[model samples]
Target: MSSEAPDPLQHIGAALFRPLGVEGVYARTALYEDLVERLTAFISRQRDRSAEILRFPPLMSREQLEKSGYLKSFPNLLGCVCALQGTEAEIRAAAERYEEGADWTRALAPADLVLSPAACYPVYPLVARRGAVPPDGLLFDVAADCFRREPSRSLDRLQSFRMREFVRIGPPEEILAFRQHWMERAQRLAAQLALPCRLDAASDPFFGRVGQVMAVSQLQQSLKFELLIPYYAGAKPTACMSFNYHRDQFGVIWGLKDEAGATAHTGCVAFGMDRLAVALFCVHGLELARWPGSVRAALAL
Candidate 1:
């Protein structure tokens, strides 16, 4: 027998994902989809019943993205929708150029929509439109198919993925308390899945020189945390879950206020559904029958 060890990453790719000829984009296998469904159900059972559940499409208004400051903070990562404009003849000429192996995308113009970068982004605007928040504030369970421009072969770094977020909007104290509660709860959930993980202070992948300052500020203020799980032996751990405290940033931009007329503080606990499934398959064998009984029971798989 060969002395080389089995490549875990290769095994995972073959078992869980079907490549779509793109580096980071993939079509999940049935086994993977089943696992994701079970995981979603398990997570849903843990959510606050009072939270309003909302599902958003992958595309969001470009105007909303600009107002949210994402365009400024992560310009490189944002994916804008574009289309060929002008008369039918112009469009046909543009298409003909592509058939002759010339640049065709140059004729494209920006559309009104852009890919959503996060699940919780649209919630703020919707809530703000409803006027002042109640004294108890608002809790939302939101999910979206999000996209980013960065593409790579790294198993955990997907270009397009699903994000599930539990968002809390209220006073600063309440937001802080909510983050703390989820911080602890996430650890327990990891244990229930029998995955080795750690909670670490983290920062967003902000862009440019000014973003460096913003990242430092975020770390100093303890604004972000991630639940990291090792996916392969030699590689660094992957972040499967993130906890973020947005302070009053979203409130200020969207004009969201609490019953007392103060800008609402916002925080969210986000689960990387694809990354979590990969982690599960990495820790436990790909075979569902081989997984721990407790974990199977927890997910009711």
Candidate 2:
């Protein structure tokens, strides 16, 4: 027998993901889905019970996205919905061009919606519509099928993935405290899963020269942190979770305010569901039954 170890990423791809002939997109196996469900349940249990649970579709209003400043900050990663417009003849022409292997997508125009880039993006607008937040603040558990335009062959970097976030909005002090609490809690959660990990200050993939400044500011302010775990041998660790402090950015755009009439500060603990599952499989081997007893018990698998 060969002395080399089995490739965990390859094993996961074969057993868990069915590729759709697209980089970063796959149809997941039942086993994978089951694992995700367990993860979701476990993570949900960690949230404050008073949190309002909200689930959103994969699409959000394009206008809202523009308003949220994602367009300016991460335009390269944004995916907009587009469709053939004009008369039936125009639509037929576009379809014919597509069949002819021409650039048919040029005929399509931007629709009113865009694929949601993050699970928490839609929550701000919804909460703003509900009027001012209560004095003690608000907590929300939100989940969605999120999308990004970046395509990679890496199994852990899916272009279309599920994200779950626990969002907090209120006074700056409370928001900061909430992020700190989750930052510590995330480490414990990772330990329970028996995954080797590290926490590091991180920055978003902002776009262009202006974005470079913003990214530096984000890091200097300690506004973003990521919990990274190894997804493959010899490769840099992948970020499986993020803690972000928006610091009135979303509040100002969405008109969210505290009961005292000040703009609310916002922060979220985001779980990259697919990435986390990949980390677990990478660290624990392909068989769930053979995983560490503590991890199995923690996930209740």
Report the C-alpha lDDT of model 2 over 86-154, residue by residue, as the tens digit. 999999999999789999988989999999999999999999899988998899999999999989977
Model 1 misplaced regions, further than 4 Å: 1-7
> Tens digit of lDDT per residue, candidate 1, span 1-301?
9998766599788888998999889998999999999999999999998999999999999999999999999999999999999999999999999999999999999999999999999999999999998888889999999999889987898999999999999888999999999999999999999999999999999998999999999999999999999986666999999999999999999999977789999999999999999899988978899899999999997
TM-score of 1: 0.96
lDDT of 2: 0.92
TM-score for all predictions? 0.96, 0.94
Q: Which 10 consecutive positions of candidate 1 have the poorest summed lDDT?
A: 4-13
In model 2, what are the clashing residue pairs, if there are any? Answer: none
lDDT of each: 0.94, 0.92
